[model samples]
Target: MNLEKILAISGKPGLYVLKVQTRTGFVAESLTDGKKITVNLKSNVSLLSEISIYTYEGEKPLTEVMQRIAVKENKGQAISHKEDNAKLTAYFKEILPEYDEERVYPSDIKKVLNWYNTLQAKGLVTDEAPAATSTSEEIAAEEPVKKAPAKKAKAKKEE
Candidate 1:
């Protein structure tokens, strides 16, 4: 469910995974086609983690919204975004009840649904909780293991 590297580049179809950072910009691999492309720094690239949906209470992170959709759909593909606007809006309403109807347009809903479907197809969206070992493991991540220094080899005398 990690959307940290997922990006939605404007003018680019489907989602992409951030690959490498270059001097001028960065390289991204398209999730739809598995092809890499370089994008300039001036390009409009939106990280999925940073994107949020307008809600009545406030702005809800797109990650949480996507997770909700995954739960609702049991981690399966959701309804097609190509469907009619009314049906898309209704489906979106089910996913986010407090979504601001005025601020969130049909196009936006379509994008969200489309992205969710793509992620689900790639097996990124999941409803199951992450597994943890031990009964009282309190930490979210385990500490990094330290590596031992390499031993120096003795130099052989010339014979």
Candidate 2:
């Protein structure tokens, strides 16, 4: 479920995992194949973490959309991206009813489905919810704290 390291490089064939950082850009290993390549700043690269889909309310993060797909499919691979445009659109609609049809294209839908399948094949998709960090207040309530040693009574300066 860690999409931060996953990326879509423009003109690339499949998903890639961001690896070492370089002076100009960074090294990325193709998820389809273990091939590693250097991606420069000039190369158009997008982290899956930063991608989003247009929705009626606003933009929905790609991760959230992927999660929805996982839930709907019971953590299995989604429909093949190779499916016809109509089918893809319908499936996407079922997952995200509010998706902005005007802004979201069939190609975009295909990419999402493809990505989800790729992630699933790699065993990256999960049914369990992401672990949530407790807020400061919640943490404080859960753990008891010992009182700080009373400022050592200034040793009686009775000299």
Candidate 3:
């Protein structure tokens, strides 16, 4: 998937939280891959903290790595986290697209390319070129306007 599609679904990958019917009891879950980690509201689950990590093997979902890391090791305490689109964009750029004609669509790849551009513009990811700057009336108010280099001067010399 492209960065935009990822960003659109990023919110879905956080710790699931809910209150029990009593309203006094609460349940929270850290879901990684297909695993479910449950914790109580009164206490914290270090092993259950959910954070987003990026990987680009292209064979497995990012969630798979998360699950592996979760089950193999405690990963310390769980720190609730949401995916940062900018980080995801940088990751995407670092992992060049290997779209095969039979495997993926050009338009799908283009969407990712566009997403990368958007992230770069937002300063979430760094590209070779510096970010573009724009001047508006509000900005011009702060500085004196300079006349365009006088074409007449050059024209007179030519004459």
Candidate 4:
């Protein structure tokens, strides 16, 4: 799934899809309400693609974490974010055992789950990489490859 265009603005309720780019910043439509709003450059906006969770090894990108959850849940919605902290922690541990409890708080886990559900509900979550390859392969098979022209040999220098 591509989250590059999806954003999580601080102090905002739900995720937003980036729409038109403005001179100052850009306009975005809320995934929950479908209302458009202009987000200024100074605003605390984070692309979902840029978010990451702290882990024992290092930080794991949100995309990879979401993909793990998607696979674990069979591409279905994860447990509700409203679930208790213990439950949430357990679930996240099962998915990412090395997640740093100190750095990655319960609230962060909830947000990730909630965002995943929202994205899945909007049909934005997808296993498209493989499908894209198959389509590309099909196109390649249908089209013939064009070969580059061979260069002419240069004449030998005279003694």
Candidate 5:
């Protein structure tokens, strides 16, 4: 359920996976076509991991919303994003009843469904909860060890 490197670039149709960072920007591969493209820093970019949906009480993380969709669809593909706006809104309501109707537009719902389906097709969507402790341990294992710098010894003055 880690969406760490997944991104949504404005003016782009589908999602992208962040591949590498450059001096000016970063390289991203499209989720739909796997084509690599270099995006400049001025372009609008949003990490899916940081996206959240507006709710009546508060904002809900995109990951949690995606996870709920996974459970509702049993980790299968959701309804087509091209479905009617009314239908899409109905479906989204069932998924998140508290979603702020005024704030959460139909287009946003469609994007989420479309993104979820894309991830599902890639076998990246899972219903299982993320293992917190294991993830921390794995991160620790992946991190390189840092060595302390040697201290210089003081020079003794002549007696």
Candidate 6:
């Protein structure tokens, strides 16, 4: 399905799963439908590991992170972070044309789009289903693992 279909489903309250594989590891899980979007990174991964986003009609998502941004506004990192977020938001806006601008603030809009692009950049969203294929080398590669001596069958013959 395309972005429109996905967004349409997102408009309702339900559960959806998005399976993805990034450079780091595989991420597969289901999300609870709500008014706002949220992103959560898995354990043993950096900031880029995992993320979630919900629509803005509900409560504000990423409340803590936004608070942190507020506290660290003067720090050098804030400028760079904001710039990066802006880039992400702009990219998202280009892809998601249906986003409600009036309901979404510029900063929040950036966060939502950033979350979406991060998924794309991490190879989460795909236009096609994953394919499994066989190769000549794979057959040979399987021989060794399959050829390990089998255990003796249980003796079941009636005497």
Candidate 1 lDDT, 1-159, residue by residue in tens: 778889999999999999999999999999999999999999999999889999999999898899999889888999999999999988988999999999999999999999999999999886544333444344424555578998999999999
Give the per-residue lDDT digits (tens) of candidate 4, residues 71-115. Answer: 999999899999999999999999999999999889999999999
What's the CA error at residue 38 for candidate 2, in Å?
A: 0.7
Model 6 alpha-carbon miss at residue 23, Å = 32
lDDT of 3 by residue, 1-159 (tens): 112112212224433323232344344332223233333345432221222332233443333333332333243212212235455433333343432334433333343434333333343332233223556975688788988886754435544
lDDT of 2 by residue, 1-159 (tens): 668789999999899999999999999998888899999999999999889999989999998999999999999989999999999999999999999999999999999999999999989897654556689999889998878887866667656
State which candidate has the highest TM-score. 5
In terms of lDDT, model 2 sits at 0.92
Worst 10 residues of 6 by lDDT: 1-10
Reference-based lDDT, residue 91, model 1: 91
Alpha-carbon shift of residue 67 in model 3 (angstroms): 23
Cα lDDT tens digits for candidate 5, 1-159:
878889999999899999999999999999899999999999999999889999999999999999999999998999999999999999999999999999999889999999999999989896655545557778779997788998999999999
Model 3 steric clash pairs: 46-77, 46-78, 49-78
The residue pairs that clash in candidate 5, if any, are: none
Where model 3 places Cα greater than 4 Å from the true spot, the runs are: 1-6, 9-98, 126-159
Residue pairs whose backbone atoms clash in candidate 2? none
Clashes of 4: 0
Report residue 54 deviation for candidate 6 (angstroms).
12
TM-score of 1: 0.80
TM-score of each: 0.80, 0.80, 0.24, 0.80, 0.83, 0.25
- For candidate 5, the clash count comes to 0
What TM-score number comes out for model 4?
Answer: 0.80
